[model samples]
Target chain A: MHKIMFVLLCLLSGCAAQHNNIKLANQLQQEPPEKILSILSEKEPDQSDFAQYYLNLGYLQLLSGEFELSIDSLLKAKNEMLSLQATSISENVAAGTVNETFRRYSGYPTDRVMVHNMLALSYLFNNGIDDARVEMLQADVEMKKLAQSDSLNGQLASTHLLSAIIYELLDERSNAFISYQLAEKILKERNISLPRGLKLGLLRMSDKMGNDTQYQYYSKQYPVLSKLKQVRQKKHQVFGLYFDGVVSNKVQQSLAVPSFNGKQIVRVSMPAYTSVQHRDQHNQINDNEQKINSEVVENVDKLVREDLDKEYPSILLLTTTRAIAKYQLVKEAQDKDPILGILANLATIFSEVADLRSWNMLPATIQFSYLETDADHIVVSTNHQGDSVVELAALKQHVILSTGLSDKVFHYEQ
Target chain B: MKIQSSFWLAIVASVILSACSTSVERLDAQQQIDLSGAWNDTDSQLVAREMIEDSLSRAWISKFVKSEGKDPAVIVGRVKNLSHEHINTNTFIANMERELINSGEVQFVASSANRQEIRDERADQDLNASEATRKEMGQEYGADFMMQGQINTIIDVDGSTQVRFYQVNLELISIKDNRKVWIGEKKIKKLVKNSKLRG
Candidate 1:
């Protein structure tokens, strides 16, 4: 009765969590950008919907002149968006969609583009002219191709408007003039009214170009563009949520076993948890950042030096080791098994660690990340010899997560 | 025999426990971070390092000396994204820029992001030059070469077992010559699966 009650309680909690997630998603979907952003910031949830919520909220923030907050929310969604390929943080990042958007990362693109365009426009809108210019060029070249084929013409025209703004920033009056003209043309052709505040910039731009006729045309149309050059230069803010543990492949698994024509038997398994400990030993890893957790790092260090050497000795076979571990686990009812999905997430965590350490040592970019503990289940198995002449402990099984990268065929040169 | 065996068992168990406890060290914990170096891939990093080294070795560039010459040339054209994974080319190019500046090979156009940052930080003008002065520096030291590239992957599977492949291709094109001064490619591959554990 007690066991049944416990099981029932667990189910009830899971359902409640699910319910909350649906409510949150519905709430974010309906709210205005400011309200959406406020809600996203107020609560941190681990579900994909929450991350998506933040991404949408961030986009709205960018629209409403809250660049710093937009940058913050976008960065938050990015860190949480697990699948790699889909997240477009930038259009240039998205152009690789055909070949680059791996099946695992596909979920990220929709949300990815929201922040990407916002950042681009924010930079362009506020007058980070060159940054905006490159972003616009990249958007015009990379994203426009995709957006045009799709039914998002208004956004596409807006992208062009931002690009024109970039040209204006560089004092490249010609390019700016042409782009603005194109934007105006796009608005008219698409049958979309010129957004209320947009005409003033066109007027200002025409006046700068000394095109009296064009200037007169725009001057006659109340130019609402404010003279203040906006700079979406707010520093990103980060709030620590859950430190969700993730597993992924350490490097592109490329150590292929040479096929022995007939004699040698080769064995393989799904894949092993990339030992994160190996990332720092041989080459210099840039970990000289000022802030970091000491205890956790020390634990990682110990695991690298000792556990990795024992389990994955140089030139070792992951299959044999995991098999032995699995057999041991089964004998003792240990739940962690290679078949269970866990190793991949662990490898991804290590990869993120390696990437983070290296990313920090460079020239400063407006970047921030927060670490918080979420949840993870660790499975373990033990094995004992059943009826052997010599007493020997057999194996141990553990769960590992295989990054989705493992399944998809990657081909660059065909 | 049982007593001796139990004692040995305890020793082994203790060793195993201790070993597992300290499995990460110099291998897991990095000493310092140089985010400047591209975190994209090891093989690609090596290739860029070598190509930049090669460029620096050239006699013309080796001899050219400048007190504060920055801003090189613009990128010649688009770089193909060849790899299966979408890698941000900026991650790698940014490193190349730092190396160029460090070696004093060439300069880069101040990305508006960086330019804006500089201006914001130095709002107090007497301590630093104004925005106009900085923009002038960008023109004085224009870029000479543009770096771009792609990443690709390959996989071969025999029944359930498989072999995976990865390659990153990069090229440094000279704006003046329109010539591909340097092209570098790096490949990585892995094998997975075994029937030994089949039920």
Candidate 2:
């Protein structure tokens, strides 16, 4: 009877904590940019939410066109992320024996990779091409390092794509082709069809290099390429457009896995975006705030799902082991004493709280398009609403947009 | 009580472990240490010493001194960095400058970046100081030869192993006749084996 009572108490407490956390997140989402920045600044280093707060704050500042401030905040976030990733044996033991929630919130691999991407974008947004180039190179180097450690991720394609664009703008067509080839291979291996813009880029590069066979290969792969001819030194070039939206939050999912006796139910909290197919949804974009031809390019949500699927086996094994061990401990206690049994069950439930921590401010979907016009200035809009206006002084420009409430715009010219 | 004590013990252990940090030991500046196998002070120092020794021993130094009956004035030009890494080319240039000046075989002039500042100070001195101490403009020594260089790095990485090759090539060219006086090159190769776990 006491064990039953203890279980009830534990469940109530866990539920309350979870509810409060959700409330905090929702509050943060609704808060103003200045308010978010101030809150993040006020947070102490010892606070559990310090790292997450900075990530949110950095992203907020990034969207507000405060690139310098964002760089500072993002660097802090990077330091925190690094420390969290360096998990000691003691932290591991605590998580296993006491409570998984006791461990520091090391962000998901995707979250860490996005931090580098955002930092690079932040520099790019400020028109610091050299610094942006450095950041992108660093991002590629980091992904390579992660690959060496057998860590599979989804951001490699995006990073390579960004590098290719930067190289193209800098008039390094050969380098751009190399990055584009890498991106194409990664996407192909992941079974994702190439984006129209990427195919066009490959087609243009092959044509420029005078590789007739390679140009023919891409031309066949993308039917749209045959309709659009490659134009290198035109008076106006079609610039690429990328739209970003908020990534989905985490939710708990209960899975039944085979165990020692029968099957045990375990709760695994994962990014809710991973379950939803975002490719079907199209974001409406206006060039210079006017309706124009646009199409969906890349959905990061699907890539994230593919990465999670690759790690599902390990997640299942570890979660099943934890569940079985807890069940056995509870059963042993019940055999010893009824009160002790209740306490053990209570401890297990409270300790088994899923690791729901992630970089929630990331975009759920990333869409791309190519706009060809003679206008030197264009106002970008999403969903029939004007977001931000950009000036294109060069022949080629790369535009980035965060279609969230911030409605951020960053453009690069060459 | 037993369970409560065990829980507290675990918490205490975790706190102590989290607080622990790696200890560091200081070493001699000249001692060579190859961590990460990237460029380091030892490599920089080695290249500096060798390049300086080779440059001064060239026939141009003797020929110029014999013809002009004075040490040839030299200026350091822009040292282009065409490598993958963001190396401080200025540091390498400073090393070369120090060695060339110390050898007393050649006179040194300010770099283009420094010449503007030096001239501005001289102008300021002319306005603010006594005439005797006021340095006159256009009295500066013109360089007989300019030393310029480029640093290049090539890296090949496979799995947990990587090989980095760095080549630094410097040229001493006669400003008057547009003739190449001396060319010096130094190469370094490092085979770095990073652990799979750490990479």
Candidate 3:
């Protein structure tokens, strides 16, 4: 019995090579994106954890201005996610016997949606407009499927806004209008205010499509529609996206209760989110004629917290069941042999670690701004990263993507 | 007894290693192998063949030939991929070009990128090649029609099962008159059911 307990302890220890994602998240806040990207590139993640690994690596690659590499990594991550969607009997058994971390990380619904969103942006940065449009269509399908499953799981306003921008760039005004409306609906559903760019896009598309009813309705709500005339007269339309500070990390929370008449401890471990105070950076675009301040389009911090809250009950039940089973095993061993009981208790305590893996490299908030101008170039600035001069092509539309965590700025024009 | 136990362990280890080892088998290029049920070369080649055949059989080709009194010249245009997958439309276009050129019924001209390269080569010939062998510019055939199309897909996924439907639409438009002379379409549907467990 003692030898069996020793072998079990060795197996659990071998499987307990947990990644310190919290430390990596902290490093991402302090270090430059390129340095962190190189570090991530050097580290080989476990085979089952490739989804989470590639998600972080792809986002970092995007921030580091490796658009092609970013697209490749994001695609691999997407494939990994798709393959992991199926229920794995062996993983389930391991999870029940050992810990939840033994199972593969089959990304959350929000992560799935964001993967397509990031892929769209990466394709855009690589000047593949058609590919970007394809990503938008895929994102729409994913969001629809997620909505059918649960209304709130994949209602990401940023994705819709990005889709609207891509559609408008492709000269599909009708689709653009629908995307803007979808973004508005999601924001309204979440009780989040609509960004300025979304409002302007809706009004512009509605007017262009000759939807008098929608135009009139929005005109009454936001008098800013009156400026649509002047905006339409401009020769260029510029859209800017800002990715703010790093998202919060998931930490392990442990609860130990004395059971079996205070002889053994039943330890329940769970993944939790500690409240993190992120810096609120002001972002904007300047075309020398007017200054447009970006507004929050998606609050990833809030979305991640809500996702964890929804999964809390299931995680709690699993942890409790495992804890009870471990306690019973300990009691049975003690009834037979005291040394074996001690060994079993030690193994149980050491193996009861929470699964703390997540796509923690995401931005805290995604912000957006729209500008209509005839200027040849625009200066985009954030309170954290200094100003970047973006030379607009002679095209009618352009998209400028920047992140507060990096100095790089990616531009897509049409 | 110890030798027997060691021999059985070795046999078991060999079996496990063989199971885990990678194996490769060469197969014919035309053989259809469906894995993951996404778009593949087989779909591209088969779609191109069927669509080009349908286009060639239409009345537009004979009408253009009879009116012009010669084989009508054609050029390939952009084939946009609007599907969810990152499909290389280049291969599909190449397949179509090969079929149209090999059919010998219509004249296929260089595409825009190829036209530029040929023009550059001709200019270089003027600079370096012998006078008789030098190719002249401004004498290239101008295509009467341009072929363009887009690939679109509709995917429905439930749990581990997915139904993917792809639609490809191609059009041949008169370069001078801006009239659509020929329209072609091809579709493919696949159902994929993933295993619920991994070993």
State the RMSD for candidate 2: 6.0
Top DockQ: which candidate number?
3
Ranking by lDDT: 3, 2, 1
Residues B40-102, model 1: lDDT tens digits: 445445545665676666544433344224334444234444332335656566655665666
Model 2, residue A139: distance off in Å is: 3.8
DockQ of every predicted complex: 0.03, 0.17, 0.64
How much does each candidate deviate from the true structure in C-alpha RMSD?
24.7, 6.0, 2.3
Residues A1-414, candidate 3, lDDT per residue (tens digit)? 666667566556434534455667789888888988887898887876788889999999999889999999999999888788777888877777668887888888889899999999999989988888888888887877677544577679999999999988887889999999999988998898888788888888888889999888887778855565544478888899999898988888887778859887778788999988876676889999899998899999989888888888988888877887888889999999988887788778877888877789999999999999999999999887899999987888888888888888888887
Docking quality tier of model 1: incorrect
lDDT of each residue in B1-199, candidate 2, tens digit only: 9999999999999989877867789999889988757777787778877998999998999999999999999998977665545566778788889988999888999898789999999999989989888889889899999998888777776656767899999999999998999999999998977553311
lDDT of 2 by residue, A259-312 (tens): 454323233332233355443333443454344434444455555565556656
**Largest TM-score belongs to which candidate?**
3
TM-score, every prediction: 0.33, 0.76, 0.94
Per-residue lDDT for B1-199 in model 3, tens only? Answer: 9999999999999999999999999999999999989899999999999999999899998898788899988888999998888899999999999999998988999898998888999999999999989988889888999999999999998767779999999999999999998999898999988897766
Worst 10 residues of 3 chain B by lDDT: B154-163
What Cα-based lDDT does every candidate model obtain? 0.40, 0.67, 0.86
